[model samples]
Target: MKTDQSLRTVIVTRYILPLREGGSLPALTEADDDFKYVLKFRGAGHGVKMLISELIGGELARFLGLKIPELVFANLDENFGRTEADEEIQDLLKASTGLNLAMHFLSGAINFDPSVMKVDAETASKIVWLDTFLTNIDRTFRNTNMLIWNRELWLIDFGASLYFHHSWDGWEEKAKTPFLMIKDHVLLDKATELRKIDLEFKSKITPEILSSIINLIPDDWLHWRDTELSPEEIRTVYFEFLKIRLENSEIFVKAAEDARL
Candidate 1:
């Protein structure tokens, strides 16, 4: 019942383009001033609910002190469906500097790999605290959706978040300990300064960002009537958890600042 009943017949096709020397999907786009935005089309596995989750979850995480990429919803016409990025969008991206982590273009500007990122125990602890608060289980060792832009860490790809909606009774228990935040298994623990900064600036998050997060929930994604939980209810729960985490971020931040290494 929560599905966006409005988009029942909309065919959201944004054609896939191949990047040279790369296997990932990076849509070709033109420039707009100086910002490089990804050209994303609605794909088969990308339902409205999942898109909502990506936007809401992403915005929420950004508000909670994580670095996130800017997002936009491009409205496509019949002619624009899955077509290459226009001359403008492409130019914008080409002129831009910094890392790009689009589904199509997952490249690090430098030769940085997670294996040697030097993520320490304390930074890992803060990451675990953030992930657990968000109920995000996708940032594991192999699938840590991260990128380094301008030597700063940015989190991306949050479509798999909110797994507590599934049939897991003891999911809350996972939040009790901060162990999942490991040095090497997930984040490059070497991001100690970033972690300290993240803690220092946690209070600057605005309320509009939080409200935009709650409002972006696509109606279809709420899963209102399922025997399990609905996305709406799940998001409400997440909002509360996030508020608490933001208020208590100092606890984890202090831990990182006080770490040995």
Candidate 2:
């Protein structure tokens, strides 16, 4: 885990255009740092939890040494939305007048196609393990949220990964349950060695590392919802959930192995 650098905060200087690819309507934004990012708003229809999921999933991928774009906090000023002619985008910008999540945009990167690009067994296993561990239901052949940048595969758009957060009523039980969706993962066939990858990742992802990553989320994003749980308490829930998943990863690993057969 690279703990040397934390997520940087950049003010939104310009909202260039909308990507129109995903339902949330992420935009091509130029931040104060002069870098363009795919900005995910806090007030989008998907809500703040989606941002939380993106941050957690992307950071976890980074921790596992996978290729993921750098995530930053994009600060939106009140007048930032005035220039957008689209009413829907104007409304979206108006609602998201504060901190939002931004993924550093990779220019000229092509969508990953399995037939054209080959991934090694170990890399495939690690990616499959990650998607399975997080219960990410988005990375199938039809909608593989992956990119080929600089001749390497990069994981992107994790807002749909942690579906358990949408309804936390049975989160504990669901955390331990098998992620049956691994069978549809784009990299499942190439993940021939699950047990070895699981064991290696288990040792690397300690409780401390998880806590540190979870702590990176801003307080507003964590506590803004009308829930009784304080920001710290909510973070604790995530930590515990992840720890339990890591401890019982064998259940998920076996499921992935079975899916491979």
- lDDT of every predicted structure (CA atoms): 0.47, 0.90
- The residue-by-residue lDDT of candidate 2 on 142-211, one tens digit each, is 9899999999999998898878877777778888989998889999999997899988999999877998
TM-score of each: 0.52, 0.96
The positional error of residue 55 in candidate 1, measured at the CA in angstroms, is 2.0
Tell me the spans in candidate 1 whose CA falls farther than 4 Å from its real position. 1-35, 39-42, 82-112, 120-123, 166-185, 188-212, 218-261
Candidate 1: deviation at residue 78, Å?
A: 3.6
**lDDT score at residue 253, model 2, on the 0-100 scale:** 93
Q: Supply candidate 1's per-residue lDDT for 164.
A: 50
Weakest 10 consecutive residues of candidate 2 by summed lDDT: 1-10
Instruction: Candidate 2: list runs displaced more than 4 Å.
Output: 1-5, 224-226
Pairs with steric clashes in candidate 2? none
- Top model number, lDDT: 2
Clashes of 2: 0
Query: What are the C-alpha RMSDs, in order, of all predicted structures?
Result: 9.4, 1.8
